[model samples]
Every structure is written in structure tokens, then in C-alpha cells.
Target: MRVPDWIDETRISYDAVAGSYADMLRGRLAEEPFQRGILGLFAELVRGGGPVADVGCGSGRITGFLAGVGLEVFGIDLSPVMVEVARRDLPGLRFEVGSMTALDLADGSLGGVLAWFSLIHVPDGEVPGVLAEFRRVLRPGGVVLIGFHAGAGVRHLTEGYGGHPMNVYVHRRSAAQVAGWLGEAGFTVEGELVHRPDPKTEGAFVFARR
Candidate 1:
């Protein structure tokens, strides 16, 4: 599918299930390995007291956590409903409805960017452009940590979890492929972490500095 259509479909799919997803995955989604990866990501990419945007920031958990760590945080999700729920749930933080392929943030404006599971919905053929947009939004030396499933092939999804319809895609790439894309995205690969997020999910956490 073309990227625009893919993104539109993703937005529609997530809008349908935002509330239920937030509730169902609240405490359940934040596991030890995920936490560990985020912490490691923090050490490698983000430090403190600066601007950051979490693309596909569903529920705003990581965004809020990063804010608590003292970085100025902003989150963007494709689903308006998800953005609304995030705003309602975390009034202290800011949330916007938007596409990851394009952000309203200024060029070379951010300190770091986090895209955990955000790229899963992106078509493999269109990921380079997404990565380029990510690079465009970041400062010259800024960093971005993108986490995605580690494996092979593609997954075109149409389902729902917790009363929310799921429009997801899974594109598993090797470390070398990831590194190559990171470099092409104007980022330098600093580190990587690979672990099974669950029985069904094995993920690679790639830390790249712009």
C-alpha cells in the first residue's frame, strides 16, 4: 500500500480503539525489558532538560515518564481519539494528533525522538522516507531510538485488541539493515538491544545519534 493510505488506515484503525487500548495495556504494557531498553535508550540518546517528541505516543506513558525525568516532552499520535485520551489522562503533558511521516515540529529542533513500536505500521517500502522525516525533525547531533519487532517479512494486520481495532504491520529487519537505514537517515548507530518482548514478539532496540 502507498504510505498515505497506510497512514490514513492506521489513524482510522487506532481511532476506533483508543480508549480500550489505553485501559487494557496500561500497566500491562510496561514490562521490565521494555523499561530496561528505555533506560538504556535514555543513557545513549536523551539526557535531560530539552525537547523531545514521541511519535505514535499512544496513552503517553513514555512521554510522561520522560517528562518526569525533566525533559520537555511532546507526544504525537495519528489517532485523534488517542490524542484526546492522552490529553485527558495526562493533563500535565501535551499531546497532538498527527502522522509520523510528517510532524509540525521545526527542522533541527529536537534533542531526541522516541518511536517505540511506531514504525510497525509503516510499509517497509516507505520506511526510508519516515526515517528521513525523523532525521529532519532532529538536531544535527540529536538521537533517535526506534524499537521494532526483530525477524523477517511483513505483517499486514486488521483486528482489534481491547475493543480497539488494530491496523498494524510488522517488518522485521536485521541489525545491518537497521544500521544502514539509520545511517541513511543521518543517524549514527551507537548501540542495539535484542530480546523477546513476549512469546510472540522479539524486538530490536536500535540507538542512533543524528
Candidate 2:
């Protein structure tokens, strides 16, 4: 299959900074109480349903967190280096190199899918297909939690962690817009939360059920 230019760029960019990115974000859950709480809620909701996949799981940080909360969880990332770092840093959990657009799972297999700040790299045109893939893998009443930078437009990153030169675009979308996409992908909007996580950017969290 031919890889998309953006996916290739994102994979390379993250591979270049995999170790540094892991180090930088290792303790993020400790600082973000709201995010942690939301994750806990997700875990609670999907606990007994079945296994969960953390799509675009970077370094397995959130994957580990979900497991710590008692959910049967695994992780998948586009960058092989990121998967290596995740396996090395977080043992006893499953981490694989894969793409969100083409998950290697059976139909109606997963109970939940978590796209934590990962979909920000996907373009608007591809969002629907990706969400449809999520829906296809999830059983009836399965849930999906998406975290993203809330707003419009894109941010280009020239330099990333450890001063690594990167060619990546961070695409931001509104909660309502993402909710609409989720609905189109056969999901029911459970709730959407928009908050200012920092002075420069607002964050959006959308919970949907398939």
C-alpha cells in the first residue's frame, strides 16, 4: 500500500524524537488531573466489555495508565521507534507498530478506542475514514475517546523534542466538528468537553459510543 505523505512525515518525525518524546511526556499524566480523571472514567466504562486499543499510542503512557486503572488495554503507533521505546519503557503491556487508518483487528473486536492527542496529526479529509475504522472495530455500545487541540487550522512544527527537525502538521478541529464526524461514522455523541489547558491552546475531549 502507498503511504500518505503526512503519515510518512509524522512517522519519521516521531521516530527521530522517540526517546526524547518519551522522556518529555513520561510524567504528563501526573500533572494533568483532568486528563487522568477522564481516562479513569473511560477505563471504568470499558472495563468488562473487552480489550481496548490506544490508537496512536505514543510511548504507551496513556496505555499504561489505562492498564493501571484495570482495563485490558494494548497500544499501537505508526512509528516503530515509538513502539520500541514504549515496549522498552513499559514492560508487560502490548505495544505494536500500526496505523489508526488500518487497524489489524477483527470486526467488532474492541470494546473501546482511545485516540489521545493523536488524531491532531490527521488531516480533516481523512478523519471520517479513520473514525469509521474505529467504528468498524468496535462492538455495539463500544466507546471511543478522542483528545485533541481544540480550534481551527494547522500548526507546522519545524523542530520537535531534542531539537530534531520535523516536517509535521498539527491539525486542530472544534469539538462540534469532531462530534459530527463521529456521528457520521456510526457513533452517538456521549459528551464533549472543551477547556483551556494552557494560555496558548485549548483542548477538546469527545466521548462517543458506537
Candidate 3:
């Protein structure tokens, strides 16, 4: 399927820096275990054994991690280049080029959804709609784990993300605002965590489930 504008969207776009971005983050995050902790939140919230969907999965780091832990995990990103890098690095897994706002899977098809820092570039107005889409693809009792930079300003990241120019890449909002979006999407937040201790993020991490 052709990628959507939103998926193709973001300033520090995921497509351009696909390989280096993955390499950089994988090296930086592997020892930290923050990513593992965040996904673990989903395991705690959801009841199912999970045929999980890792939305906005750039380069499949978290997706591969979930699979390594024995969960059936499939990843989807908006950038073909990003998906390609993921497949190249992790040949045994499934990674597609798609947007979280319009997942290719069937409704209620997932037991859990993971949105890492992938949504960092999403504008505030678009989050509810995206979350609604997240809700649509998830089972009624599915879990959602979204993590991003939380603050009051509209931040746009630069070329470092390895994406396009028109794609405005960085954006963030308060924790309450994110919680509201999840609620609108029919999710019940089970936990909210601020991982500033990680030294890489300035925002909080939120875990919400349907």
C-alpha cells in the first residue's frame, strides 16, 4: 500500500536516517533497558499473550525485542526506507511500511500496541485521531503503551532523525493531554511514568489500555 501523508510526515523524518538512527539508538538503549521497561508495561496491562503490533516501529528495535521475549510481534512504520533497514537488520521478523493512524491490520487484531518515541513528531491536534485508530485495531481489552517527550511547547526536531524536510519531526504535550487522548480513544490508563532518569528523554512515559 502507498504510504499516507501523515506517515510520510515529520521533520526529523524516520526515512532519511533509517540505518544510522537504528544503529545509534540500539547502541544507546541496549544497556539502558528503558525500552524493555516500557514494553513490559504493556505485558502488565494486557491480558492476552499478544500478537502485538508495534506501531511507528522505526527499524524494529522494540519489535524485535518483543519477539525475542517470545511474543508474536509485527512492526509497521510509514517510511519504506525505515522498514527496509529494519528488515535488513532483523531478517527473521515482519516489518511493513504503514502509518499508525491507519493500520493495515483488521480491527481488534492486536492484543497490545507499542508507540515508542515514534510519536514525538506528531502534532497535538492529530493525536486523538491517531489514538482512535490505535483503539480500532486493538481488541477491546488490548493494551497500549505510548512514550514521548512531555512538555508545554511545540518542539520540532531537526535533520538528525534521518527523514524529509517537509516532515516536521518533533512535537510534545503534557501528560494529562496524552491521557485525554487515550480516554477519547476508549482506553483506560493503567500507569504513567516519567523516565527522566534515563538521561535521553525529557518527558514522561504513559501506559494506557482498552
Candidate 4:
């Protein structure tokens, strides 16, 4: 298969910053009570159903958290360097280099899917396909929890994660828009959470079920 240029760009960008990115974001999740509550709810929803896949799980932060919450979880990321960091940091967990656009998993095999702020880099035209891939891998009634930047339009990021040069487009979207996409992709929109961590940026979490 011919990989998209954006995917290659995203992979390269994240690979360049994997270590710094991991270091910067480490322990940040502990400060977000709401987000932790959300993850807890997701874990409760998928408990005992099957293993969970944390797609685009950079450095396995959420993957490790999910495991702590008592869910059988593994991580997949597009950047090999990120995957390496994840494995190095959390050697007991499973971390693989992969993409959400084409998950390397069997059909109806997952209890849940977590795309935590990971889908923001995916272009709009490709989101539906990615959601479909999520739906394809999930068992009936399996859940999906997606977190993204909440707003309008796209932001082209040139440098980030400890001042490393990057080539990635971050698409900001609304909860309603994401829920509609989930609906169109055969998921039942279960919950929506909008949060403003700072005055300039808004983030959203959309929970749905297949």
C-alpha cells in the first residue's frame, strides 16, 4: 500500500521528538481530574469485555494508566521512535508501531479504542475511514473514546515538543462534528466532554459505542 505523505510526515515529526515529548508530558495526566474520571468511566464501560487498544498511544502514558485501572490494554503508534520509548518506559506492556488508519488487528477483537489527542493530526477527509477502522476492529457494543482539540480549522505545527522541528497539521473540531462522524460510521454517540485547559485552547472528548 502507498502510504500517505501526511502519515510519513507525522511519523517523522513525532519520531524526532519522542523522548522530549515523553519527558514533557509525563505525569501531566495526574493533574487532570476530569480526564482521569473520563478514562475511569471508559474502563468501567469496557471492563471484562476484551482487551483495549490505545491507538496513537505516544509513550504508553494512557496505556499504562488503563492497565492500572484494571483493563487489559496495549498500545499502537505510527512513530517507531514513540513505540520504542513506550516500550522502554513500560517494558511490561505491549507497544507496537502502527497506524489507526489501518489497524493490524482482527475484526471484532477489541473491547475499546482510545485515540487520545492522536486524531488531531489526521486530515479531515481521512477521519471517517479511521473511525470505520475503529468500528471494524471493535466487537458489537465495544466502546471508543476519542480526545481532540475542540474548535474550528487547522493549525500547521512547525516546531514543538522541546523545540524540535516538526511537520504536522493539527485539525481542531467540535464535539457535535465528531459525534456526527461517529454516527455516520455506525457508532452510537454515548458521551461528549469539552474542556478548556487554557484560554486559548479547547479540547474535547467524545465517547461512542459500536
Inter-residue clash pairs, candidate 3? 10-167, 10-168, 11-167, 11-168, 11-169, 13-163, 16-162, 17-162
Question: What residue runs in model 2 are displaced by over 4 Å at the alpha carbon?
Answer: none
How many residue pairs clash in model 3?
Answer: 8
Cα lDDT of candidate 2 equals 0.93
Which digits, one per residue and each the tens of the lDDT, describe model 4 over residues 39-79? 99999999999999999999999999999989999999999
- Backbone clashes in model 4: 0
Clashes of 1: 2
Mark the 10 consecutive residues where model 2 has the least summed lDDT. 194-203
TM-score of each: 0.90, 0.98, 0.87, 0.98
User: Can you tell me which runs of candidate 4 are displaced by over 4 Å?
Assistant: none
For residue 197, model 3's alpha carbon misses the true position, in angstroms, by 2.6
> lDDT of all the models against the reference?
0.79, 0.93, 0.75, 0.96
- State the lDDT of candidate 3 residue by residue for 1-210, as single tens digits: 875455555413666677777877775656767656777656656545458888888888888877777788888887788889889988999998777766788988888888887787676677888898888888877888888887767655555644434446567667787887888778998778776764655667778878
Off by over 4 Å in 1: 1-3, 197-200
Candidates ranked by lDDT, best first? Answer: 4, 2, 1, 3
> Which pairs clash (backbone N, Cα, C closer than 3 Å) in model 4?
none
Question: Best by lDDT, which number?
Answer: 4
Instruction: Please give the RMSD of candidate 4 to the true structure.
Output: 0.7
* lDDT for residue 98 in candidate 4, whole number 0-100: 93
